[model samples]
Target chain A: MTDRSRDGLRPSLDQPRRGFMPRFNIALVLPAQLTMMAVVIVPTLIILWLAITDWQPTQAIPWYDATPVWFWNFYDLWYDERFVNAVGRTLFVVGVCVALELGLALGLALLFLDEWPWRRVAVSIIILPMMIIPVDAANAFFMLFNERGPINHMISLVIGAPFEFSWLSHPTWAMAPIMMAEVWQWTPLMFLLVLTGLMNLPQNQVRAAIVLGASPVRIFFKVMLPLLAPVISIALLIRSIETFKIFDPVYILTRGQPGGSTETISMFMYNGAFVYFRMGYIAAAALLVLVVVISVCLVLARPMTKHS
Target chain B: MDRKLELRALRKSFGDVEAVKGIDLALNRGEFLSLLGPSGCGKSTTLSLIAGFLQPDAGEILVDGKVVNRVSPRKRRIGLVFQDYAVFSKLSVRANLSFGLEAQRVPRLERDRAVAEISEKLNLNPILAARGGELNMSEMQRVALARVLVTKPELLLLDEPMSNLDAALRAKLRGELKQIQKELEQTVLYVTHDQVEALSMSDRIAVMRDGEILQDDSTEAIYRRPAERFVAEFIGDPPINMVTCTVTAEGGVVSVSTALHRNLPLGQGEIAPGQYLLAVRPHHFQASREAAAGTVGSEIRLVENFGAEHVLHVSYGDDLVAVVVAPGFAREGERIHLALHAEQAHLFDLESGQVIALQRREAAA
Candidate 1:
C-alpha cells in the first residue's frame, strides 16, 4: 500500500484517459476556447441572471446589486404588441429574403451552365456584389431610395412628371428597400453555391435525360432540382439565419421609423437595450430569440445531414 | 431491309483536331452493329453526333431516312446508354425506368406497364424501390438499359456499356444483351474497343481507327477479309502475325517467299515484284513436335495459357511468331516445327499499308 501510494502519479498517468478533452490538443484550441468562454458563455450566464431582474444600465447601481423581479420581464414580453410584431416581421423578412434569393440565384446559375466566350468575365461581374462591404452596400441602397435620388428621376422621366416620393417615411412601402437591399447584396453568394453544385453534377445523367426525350423544363425540375437538394437546403439555412438578424439597411434607411412598421427582432433588441435602456427585458428577449433560432436550425439541418 | 439509322459523311472536329472524319454508316432495323476501335478512334464521337449530343462539323444524320441533324436531342427520340451507366442516383430504379415515359406524357397506366415489362425483362424487380446510387455496378447498368428500353426508341445507342463490368459479368451480360436485342428486335448501335465483344455479339462490325471507319462489314467477313492491315491486326485475339517477305508474280501465279518458307503460293494476281508484308493469323500456322518434310524447324520462346488452347511464340529466323496449338503440344525452349497455310495468309503493300488482293484458284472454285 505504501509503494502503491508512492507510484500513484505514475499509475494515474498510465491509466487510459477519460473524456473527450484529453484526446484533443488543448494548446491548439486554448485561444478559441478561452475567447468563446469569455465572450459567449460568461455573457450568457450574466443574461440568465439579469433576465429575472428588471435591471437597467441607467440605474445608479451595479447589475448584480439590482433587486430581482422574477418572471416579470417574460410576462411583460408576452403582452407587448411591439415585441410580438417584431418577431412576426422578422420571420416575414427571413421568408421573403431567402425565397427571393434562392429563386434569383437558381435562375442566374442556370444561365452560366454552358460555356461561352465571355462566361468567366460574366461570372466575375455577377459575383461582384458579394465582394463589397455590407455597410457600403446598405449606404448605396439608402441613397438609391432617397426622395430626390436617381430612382425618382428615372420614374419622373418615365411618367413625364416630378416623382419624388419619400420611400423611407412611408409606412408599408419602407420594407421594400430593406428587403431588396438584402436580396441584392447576398444573392450572389447563393448563386455561386448553386452554380458549384450544378457544375459538379454527373454530366452523363443530364445527357441521358436528354436522350430520354425529357423536355428542358422537365429535366430541370425532376432531374436537376433533386440533385441540387443538398446545396439548396444549405443555402436556404444560411440565408434564412442571416436575414433573420437584418439590421444594417433598416438602421441606414428608416431605423424602424414610420410608426415602427419594419422593426425586426434584432432591431427590437437593439432599441430596447441601447435606445430605451431596458437591459433586463432585452436580455430575456435575446434568450428567447436564441432558443427559437437554434431549434429551427436543428430541425432544418436534420433531413439534410441524413440525405448526405 | 429497312434502314433504321444512317450517317452520311459524318464529320466532327475539336479545334484543330478532327474527332470524326467524314464517315458513312447505316444500321438496318433490328440489326445489332458494333463500332469497334481502340481509344481515340472517334467511335464515341459518331454515336454522339447521331444522338444529337454533338453537332457534326459537316455531315447528315438520318433516322428512317429523315434528316435529324437540326432536331433537338429530346425530339430525336433516340436512346443512349453511357459508358458509366449514368443512372439517376437520386431517383428510385422504377422512377429512372419510367422517366422517359413520364416526360413523353404517357398516361400513368401505360407508364407503369412499360416499367413493369422492362424491369421484368431486365430482372430488376428485387431492386425496384432501391435508389440508383445504392445499387452495384451491374445493377446500375441494368437500370440504365431498362430506363432507355422502356421508352421503346426507334434506335438505341450504347457507348462501351460493358467497359465498367467485370470479365465474368461482361460475358454473362453480353449473352443477355444479345438475347434481349433479338427478342425485342431492337436496333442497337453498340460501341466498344474490345474485339471479343465485337466478334461475339455484333451482327456487323465497323472497325474504326484514327477517326476513320476502315472496314464496315459482316462480322465473319470482317474477320476473314480485313481490308486494311490495321483491321486484321486489331480483330484477332492473338493478333495477326506480320512477317516481311518478298512477293513475286510470274506465270499468273502470285506467291510470297518468307525467311522460313520458299515460294508459298498465295494466288494469281497482277503485281510487280517487291518486298511486302505477309499477315497470317495464329491459328493458320500448324505446329508439330517433330519436323516434317515441308515444316520449318524452330524453338518455342514463350507459351501463353488461354484455357482451351496454348499459343506458342516460336523463333522464326530472328523473329518471334505466334502459333496456336493444343495444350501440352509444346513447351517453352522446346524445338518445334511450324508450317504456314499460304492460302490463309494475306499480302500487304510495304508502302501503302493496303491489302494486296489475289484471286486464289481454290477460293474462286
Candidate 2:
C-alpha cells in the first residue's frame, strides 16, 4: 500500500509547528531579567550617582546644593590618612582571612571528603559556628578565647603559666581575631563546595591511577587537585567577595581599635557616615571601595579560567 | 608459562541474598569463556569476585594457583571492562591508556611507548588527545579497552562489554573482539545476558540462572545436546519446540507416538519406555506444498512472514508447538503436517529432565 506522509504518518505540511516557542518561554525570561535589574543594576546606578554628588542623608555638602559635587568628596578623601589606613587594613584583613580560610577550607574539605568515622559529626560541628545566633554572637564565642576564659586557663594548666595575648589590644594581633572569626564563619561554605566537587569526581580515574600504581600522594596531587580546580575557584570567588564586605565581627570585637588595625573599608564607611556623620565623604569612599573591590575580584577571578 | 586460574566453590552473599551460589570454574591459559545468563543471575558478581572488587563469602580465588582472596582489585591485575565501558572522563584517551601505567610508576618513556602501541592497535591514535566525553560510545569503549589492555594483566574480565552497543554495532564489535582475543591469546571471562553474543563469541558458555550455573558446554554442544530444558530453550532464538509424546522402543528402533496414530522413529540416544517430550528445533522440519508422507502432527496456525523469517504454530493433542519456516515461505492459517526427523529429535525424562536410555524403552515395549 502507498501512503502519503512524512516518514510514516503525518504529511510534511500537516506536521505540528515546532519553531514557534511557547509564550511561557519569554514570560519566564522577562521577569528574571527585570528582577536582576531591580535588585542589582538599580542599586549600582544610585551608588554611582551618590559617588559624584555631595549627597548625604543628614545634610548636603556646603555650596553644592546637591546637584553634583564633581569629585570634591573624592578630593577630600585623597587627603584623608584614615581613609588610606582603612584601605591598607581592608587589604590586610582580606589577605589574611582569604589565605587562612582557603588553607583551612581545603583541609576541612579533604577531611569531609574522606570516609572517616567522625566525618558526619565534624561536618555538623563545623556548620554550627556559622548557624548559631548571628555574627555579633560570634563575640560571645570569641569571649571564650580570652585571657581570663577557659582557653587561657587550659593554656596555663598545660604550660604551667597563664598565657597573655591580647588580640583585641594589639594592632597586628587584632587582625588575627577578625581573621579567626571570618574563618570560623565561612570555612564550612568552602568545605561544602569543595566536598561536592570532590564527590562528583570520576572514581574510575582514581581507581585506574591506583591500579597503574600511582601512590596516594601522587594521585591526590596530580589527579584529584587538578580536577577539583573548578570548585576551588568558585569557593575563592564567594569567600573573597564576602571577606571584602566584612563588618559584623570587626564592629563588635575591635571597632576599628588600636589605631585602625581592624578598620575594613566597609567599617571605615560605617564610621564615616554613622559615627563621624560625614555621609558625603563616606558616600564617596563607598564608591571608591566598590571600584577597588570589583577590580580586585576580577583579578582574583583570573586564575579560575582553567575551570570552565 | 601458561597458568590456570581457578575459582574454587566461589560463593558470595550480600546481606540476605546470595548473589553467587557455590560456583566452581577454572580458566586455562588463553581460553575465552562466556558467562551467559539473565539479569540478576550473578554473572556480574562472579566477574567482580574475579576482579577482587567484591569479597566472596566462602571461597578461594586462585590466580596462577595462588590464592588472592585478600588482594584488592588494584593488586589483582585482572583488567575489567564494565558494561558502560567506564573510562576516566577527565583524562584524554592517551592519558586514559597511560593512567594505569602512571599508577604503576612506569617510566615516562616506557609509558609513552605503551600508550603509542595500544593507541595504534585500537586505532585511537588520532583521538589520543580527545577527552572521554568528547568521544562517541564506541570510541570511548576502545579507550576503555586500551586502558585495561595496557596493564597486560593475566586475566581480562569483560562484564557485558557489548550490551550497550546497537544490534549492527554489536555484531561488528563481537567479530572484532573475537579476532582480538584470538590474536592476543589473553584469558578472558566475558559476561553477557545476550544468547547471540554468548553463542558467537565464547569458546564455552556457562548458562546461569538464580545464582547458579545451569549448564556449561561448548557453544555447538549446548545447541545440539543441551543438558537440561533450560539449556535447550535458552540456546535457541525461537526456542526448542516441546510437545508431549508416548515414547516406545522395540528391537532397538525407538518409536514416538504423536497426535497422529503413526509411531515415529526416535533418535539414537537411549530412552526409557514412558511418556516424554519430543523436542525439535524450528528449522528441523521440511515444508511440503501438498500432503507429504511421513508427516505426523496437525497444523493449528501459520504466519505469512516475520521480518525475514516465517513461523507456524502447530498443535498435537494437548501440545502446542512452533516451526520456523524460511523467508517467503508459507501462508497464514495454512494446514500442514510438521514431520520430525527422529534421528535428530530429543526425548527427555518427564520428571528429572534427563535423557532416557532407548534400550530400556525397547525392552519395555
Candidate 3:
C-alpha cells in the first residue's frame, strides 16, 4: 500500500504542470476579505483621518476637505473633565460589575452542580436574562426602576409605607440602576460559563478531597476554586471588556442625565459624536479607547490562554 | 475500635435499578480485604456506601463500632484512592500530600513531618515540587496514596488503584502496595475485577455477583472451596474449566463419569446427582508426554504464553480445556495425557449452580 501510493504520487511531483494552475483557494476567501475591508477597514481609516481634523458632519465642507486640527482635539480631550470623569466611571463600573457578576455566577453555578428535579428548567430561567436582546432588557430595567414600578411597590411593602423614590432621576443613585441592569443582563452568561467548567471538572478530585476529611468550605476553596480559576479568569475578562463599553442601559435608563453622573466612556462618546456632532473629536476618543482595549486584552488574554 | 468496619445489610438503588442489594461485610483492624467481582457486581457501590459518598437505602455502616449512617464523607475519616488517582491536579505534590492534614487543622510542624514520612515511604520525596497534573502515572498514584496515608484515616478504600498503570508497573506496584499496607497495618477495602490482584494482595476476599456476595472467606479458601459456580469461575487466572459429567450414588459409594474419563470414585455422599458440572482449575490437570494410569489423552490445540508459565488449550471430548504447563512443555497439535485430580475438583449442581459437597478419596492413594 505504501509503495503504490508513493509510486502514484512520484510522476505528479516529478513533472511540472503543462499549463497554469488556477489559484482557486485564494478566490474562495476573497468575498469575506472584501466584506471585512468595506465594513471595518474603510471606516477605521476614515476615523483615523477625522481624528486629526476639526470636521463635523454639519460643517459646510466635506470631511476630507476639512481643516486639520493637528493634535488639538487630543489636547482638548486630556483636560476635558467630562471625558476623564467618564473614563474613571467606566473603569469603576467594570470593576464592581464584573466582580459582582463573578461572585453571583460562582454562587449560582455551585448550586447547579448537583441535580435535582426541574434543574434544567431552573437553569433556563436563570439564563433567561442572557437570551433577552440587550436593548429590550435595558428597556425592561427602565420600567422596573420607575418610581411607580414594582420595585418601589415591593420596597413600600417591605417597609410598611407607601414610598416612591425616583431612582433614575437621582444623581447619586442613577449609576446604580445602569450598573444593576448591566450585571442583571450579563451575569447569566458568566453563570453559564462557570457551570460548564464546574460540570467538566474532574469529579474524582472532589471525591478524593471529600474522603480526605476536608470540610465542605475547604474543599470548595482549596479544591474547587483553584480548579475553577481558569474559567473565572476568562469570565471576568469577557465581562470586564463588555461592561467597560456599557451603553444601551445608560441610554435607555438615564442617558447619562442627572448632571452626567452616570456617564460611561461609551455614553460620553455617543453624546459627543451623534448628539453633539463633534465627529472629529469623538473619533480621537474612539481611537484612544481602541488602542487601550486591545493592549489590555492582549495582556489579559496571554495568561488566560496559557493556563486554560 | 474492635472492628475497623462493618456493614449491616447495606442496600442502595439508583432510581429503579438496585445497584447494591442487601450486603453484610466486616473487616478487622489491619485486615486487607478485597471485594472481588466482575464489573457492575456492586463492589464499587459497596465501597461508596462505606466511604459515605453514597447513602445506603436500607442498612447501617459502622466504623469503629459506631453507626455512621448520617455522617457526611468528610467526617467519616475514610481515605479513598480513586481509579483515576484524583491527585488534586492544581496543587504541588507536597501540597497534595499535606491537604488532608491541613484540612483537619493539624499544626504546621506535624503536617510537615507526616507529609515527609509518607513521601519517603512511597518514594515521592523526589517529586515533591512537581505539580499533580505534571507527574507521570506512577508518580500520581504515589501522590494519591501518600496524600491519604498522611491523614491516618480510620479506613482506606482503593477503587482499582492500579487500573491506569501498565502491566509492568502494576506488577511492581502490587508488591510495593502490599508492603506498604503491611508496614502501616492499615485496614483496607480494595475493589477490583482482576482476580490476580485480589488473590495476591488480599488477606480475605469476598466474591460478588449480581449485587450479592457468593462467598466471603480467606484468599486460599475462596480459591480452594468456592461456594457457587460463579465464584469458581471468577476466581482463577486461566479460569476453571467446567466439564459435563454424570454422578451416581449407589450403596454409599458415589462415582462420577465424564466423556474423557469414566467412573472416578468419590467418597460417600447423600447427593442424588444426575448431570453435574465438575469444576477443575487449569493447573489442577496434570499433563504428561506419555499415557499413565487414570490419564486420558487429549490433543494440544493452542498454547498461550505467559512469562512464567504457558496455558495449553487442549481438545477434550467435544470442548477445549485449558491446562497450565511450564514454558515450552507442549506444542500445538501434539497428543498429551491429561490426569484429573479428583480430590481437588468441585461438583456443582446443574440447575442451581451451587456446589454439591462430597467426601473425596485422596488421589495419592
Compose the digit string of candidate 1's lDDT tens values, residues B309-350.
Answer: 999999876789999999888789998888998888889888
Error of 2 at B336 (Å): 3.6
**What is the TM-score of candidate 1?**
0.91
Docking band of candidate 3: medium
Off by over 4 Å in 1: A1-55, A60-72, A156-164, B363-365
Per-residue CA lDDT of candidate 2, range B1-365, in tens? 45557888999999999999998888889988889888999998898788776789998899988999997777887887877776766667777888788778789999999889888888898998888767888887788888888889888888887877788898998988888888888889989988888899888888888888888788877877777767777778777887778977676677888665368876444456778877778777655656678875466465646688877776657666777877666666666666766666677777877655443233211
lDDT of 3 by residue, A74-168 (tens): 99999999999999898899889999999999999999999899999999999999989889999999999899998999999999999899999
What's the true lDDT of residue B141 in model 3? 90
Q: What is the lDDT of residue A74 in candidate 2?
A: 90
For model 2, residues A220-273, the per-residue Cα lDDT tens digits are 886788788777887888888888888888887788887887788888888888
Q: Which docking band does candidate 1 fall into?
A: medium
Q: What is the C-alpha lDDT of each candidate?
A: 0.91, 0.78, 0.91
Best by TM-score: 3
Q: Model 3, stretches more than 4 Å misplaced?
A: A1-28, A147-166, B363-365
